[model samples]
Target chain A: MDRDQANYLFNVMRLDQGASVTLFNGRDGAWRAEVAERGKRGGALQVAEQTAPQRNPPDLWLLFAPIKKARTDFIVEKAAEMGASRILPVQTEFTNSERIRQDRLQAHAIEAAEQCGGTFVPEVADLARLDRLLSDWPEERQLMFCDEALFDRPSPLTNGDATSSGTGTPWAILIGPEGGFSDAERSRLHALPFAHPVSLGPRILRADTAAVAAMTLWQDRLGDWTAPNSDPVR
Target chain B: MDRDQANYLFNVMRLDQGASVTLFNGRDGAWRAEVAERGKRGGALQVAEQTAPQRNPPDLWLLFAPIKKARTDFIVEKAAEMGASRILPVQTEFTNSERIRQDRLQAHAIEAAEQCGGTFVPEVADLARLDRLLSDWPEERQLMFCDEALFDRPSPLTNGDATSSGTGTPWAILIGPEGGFSDAERSRLHALPFAHPVSLGPRILRADTAAVAAMTLWQDRLGDWTAPNSDPVR
Candidate 1:
């Protein structure tokens, strides 16, 4: 990809000739490139070698019931920046909106990746039925369900330890819709052997805020907690 | 506050008389109200208390560097719903907008309180300089400064032992603006005895996302995580 990609450079950022911009090809990693030529309709850039390699993203999945358009977009963008491996929008009994523009959401994820300097963009899956999703759930992966109605319980961290001391296994964070999960849905989730129902504390969080909070908890427990201890080659 | 005072309901929600709405007095607690009277110009409500005080909020403060208009509103709203006792806008070296319309942000906090069934409205403080805030920092308070540039070290939570926990003492979560904290500001924060510099993790979270994340971490370790365990009287 070069500066002639008018959509990203000219249209989005409105860069001119000799302007330095960062580019990432996912596979080729991120690059520091300069605009070599500019034209009325398009431009060209000189590509440089990689600045950072495509590294490992946390094995985190954010499964949330879709909400309003703008808030849904906000959730997707934050999920990408928070290093989720995949984003799944599920249709629960209380999900208000059934239709979602997958392409537009995917675009938001891409933009979030570009802004946050992430080489791997989280894949936004097509909306799936919540019941079907539960039926087909994998046995190996544990889920940290953010259950607001269960206000009288301690939020079980992914490590199954209250002390926040362990990195147990790969995990996913689940957030319900605006109206919250129906009792039947809650019971079904509670019955799942792999599901760990956790409270986002006593206060009810908006769906978007729940997503961020749940991710933060999981990251604190299981994700990359340390800065690179050694000196970098650069 | 009456039903007529809600601009979103009168103009956006378009609620009519006899419509059931939730009301909160910040001190008296949450109540279920019905719009008893309505006119072209205004409306009134008759409120009946339902659920008694459910959760005790933590004495946590959220001091964030304000960003754009919409996002700043979002921060205030989310902070209130997430049970922040105080919201302070601090002017840092990298703060973009010096002037903040405090009334608009306070309204957002009120609406969020009303919507989330929160009885306590977070107090919004006047914008203060970062230096002044630090110099006047309460001795017993523990400040969790979310430092974005501290990439070479693990997050403070990773090193958080029981002794360093912010329990009992009043606490504050500080989030920087989009441009991040200046070098001098970072140094000052590092030198503060009461400040604990923490990272939200490897990925770069936006200011709003960071605020939510930091609050979640603090609440989990030190706030009301056990409040949700009692049976609902209703």
Candidate 2:
């Protein structure tokens, strides 16, 4: 344990020298560890044993352009809690923020996992150009692209055609920025074979709300909400 | 229009005396109103012709215990955006907040409607005790009670028994506080004939996330998400 963790365990949490606490490194399963040495500056922990085996979320990735700082953090935290296997910050044509703090976002993901009783912590990728990411898009993975202008249009999500997103397929959900995608970007995405454009609902949702709504819809139809106990990803 | 609104248009929005703006008061449809007078302290608006017909949301009522101030505001805003006809701040035994600012929360709902292009603004009901509210519960209105402890149990929602929630029936979604409903509250609710207890998912969601998830799930199966265009409530 480092200085900050020691301070948390000793000063904040007020744990004694032999107090047991659970720990997880995202790779190993959650472990029951005991405080060996507690000090004001630093501390030591002795790993006891595994308390729970690792439970990974589905092979789902969430891609979105970074917006305001607080909302961006909200998206990452909710994505982690909602079972996104990966979080990617894409730089779109109309993306407002020019830069993002990848480390801070990753920390938010970890904190979300810790708070939500999730064993898996989704990887938060550094900001990347949307065009470049699309260029190297995986042929096997399907992308659930949320389009704002298609609000009233019929979508496979509401229609029975959502079965096209068959089971056991790797999937990703892309949410655009507050300003939404440019026309050129929209056309290119529409032309892509693997992009399944969908609408959240009839009303316009804020960017953050759109992300959550899209994830909830996808999970309901194609993700693990249908069968959480026998989740294929788990 | 009132003086404060005139001042806002003139000072904050910089709208001229003849500028036009869309207005909706949950009764009349969205109307194109003209700024008749502009002043530093007050202003007047002339009611013009209607722009769009009133589009009321479904007969979905969202009942949630007030949480932290910001999150409570968030719940109200999201309920408005996601199409709730009524928002109720219930007082459960385990509810943390002793009181709620009904006006502030109602204002948040109005702001959400303004931002989300919603023609109908949901009515935020005053805080009432859960038992008192249940005592006068509508017999025909089905309640989709979201119980956190019933996470892995077989629910009508997942078991295809949601047919119990007949079509064209009024519905309400109840989300408890951070600590969840007390055992007595759960028992009382379970004994109610109109209450259909449902689970959001396998994971334990935060109160806010649970509220949204429950709404999405209910809207998907029993609410308007099935047929958005010909939505019965709308």
Candidate 3:
């Protein structure tokens, strides 16, 4: 441990030689560790057996048009906590943010993963244009296009929606920036067969809030986290 | 308008006479206003007719134990965006935040409401002890008690669970602190008739993420944002 780390563990946290702590390295599952040596200069931790197996979220990705600095970081953090497999920043026609610091955002994702006790840290891909992503879109993967204009239609892919509520499919959620999608982009997304448009709610949510809301709706509707509705409302 | 406001409207926004802007004052619905005068020190805005009627979310409240400063602000902002009627920062046995600045948090709610195009701003109630609030809880208001411990149960109050999934009911969502609820508090909540404990998911979510997640689930499952599931899966 470094000096600051030693001070934190020894002085602040008051950890003794035999004290236990949970540790994870993103690749391996969570493991138990104990302080092997405690000194004023530094400390040594002895890794013990695994405490829990690695658990990953469903094959879910978050594709968002980057906004301001703080909101962009908030999206990445929430995406990690919501258990997204990967996070992709897409540059749309109306996207205001010209560029994003990938390293800083990736670090935020890592910190969020640690905070939420997530075994897997979602990879935050570098910024890419929306058109390029669409051109190279995976054929089998589906998209939950959160368009508030589609408020008249039922948003959730509930068990009742037999046609589109297909479970176990690789999925992604796209949240537009505050400026919203351009007419051309909206038309294209609507035309894409793989893109399933869904409404979040009556009152519109900001992009950051929408990210978390969309993930929750997806998890409730068709993701790995299933809330079994004995009476499934479509 | 004040001097700063005049400067922002005339200089920054480059607005001249007859430029239209939307306005709201919590109680009034959205209105369109036009610049009547462009003075150096101040400006004038002539109010037009109301454009949109007053709209509000369902009678849903968010009761959460306060955490750190930034996170508490996040919860309030998100609660407003997600359409919570009121936000109550409760003091649980393990709650870390001793107090909160209600005005500052309320300002966040106002900003979020405006960003979301919401006419009605949610109220941020002063910090109150959890036990006292629970004792005086309105019998009519149902509580969506979010507990990580109940991870095994189906969390959503879907169409099938008629007993607990009653529509048009006054409701509140409770998110515990980082240290979690004391056993006594959990037991009391579990025993309460009005409190319905629900798990967020298998992977634990931080308090801020949980607030948004829970609100989304409530909106989808039972709030005014009825997702008219054609095949209602119970």
Pick by DockQ: which candidate is best?
Answer: 1
Instruction: Write one digit per residue (lDDT tens) for candidate 3, span A1-234.
Output: 557667878889989999998888777789999999987677899998899777777788999999999999999999998878899999999999999999999989978977777777888999999989999999978888889787656645642532364666788999998888999999999899788788887888889999999999887777656632221111
- For each candidate in turn, the TM-score is 0.89, 0.93, 0.88
lDDT per residue as tens, model 1, A1-234: 554367678778888888988887655668888889867777888976668876546667899999999999999999998878889999999999898999999989989998887777888999999899889987767788888876766555634442243344567888999998999999999898778888788877789988988887777766765533321111
Give lDDT tens digits, candidate 2, residues A1-234: 666667878888998889998898887768999989866576788999999777776788999999999889989998987888899999999998989999999999989988877778999999999999999998888888999877665643654445676767889999998888999999999999888888766777888888888887777677766567644553
TM-score of chain A of 2: 0.92
For model 1, what is the C-alpha lDDT against the true structure?
0.80
lDDT of 1 by residue, B132-177 (tens): 9899888878888988877656755556542365456778889998
Candidate 3 chain A least-lDDT 10 residues: A225-234
Candidate 2, residues B1-234, lDDT tens digits: the string is 666565567888998878899999886779998989866676778988999777777799999999999889889988998888899999999999989999999989999999987888889999999999999998888888988777666543655445666657789999998888999999999999888887666666778777777777766666655456544554
In model 1, the runs with Cα more than 4 Å from the true position are A2-4, A11-17, A158-168, A227-234, B1-21, B33-50, B54-56, B158-165, B227-234
Per candidate, the number of residue pairs that clash is 7, 0, 13
Order by TM-score, highest first: 2, 1, 3
Top model number, lDDT: 3
C-alpha RMSD of each candidate structure in angstroms: 4.3, 2.2, 4.9
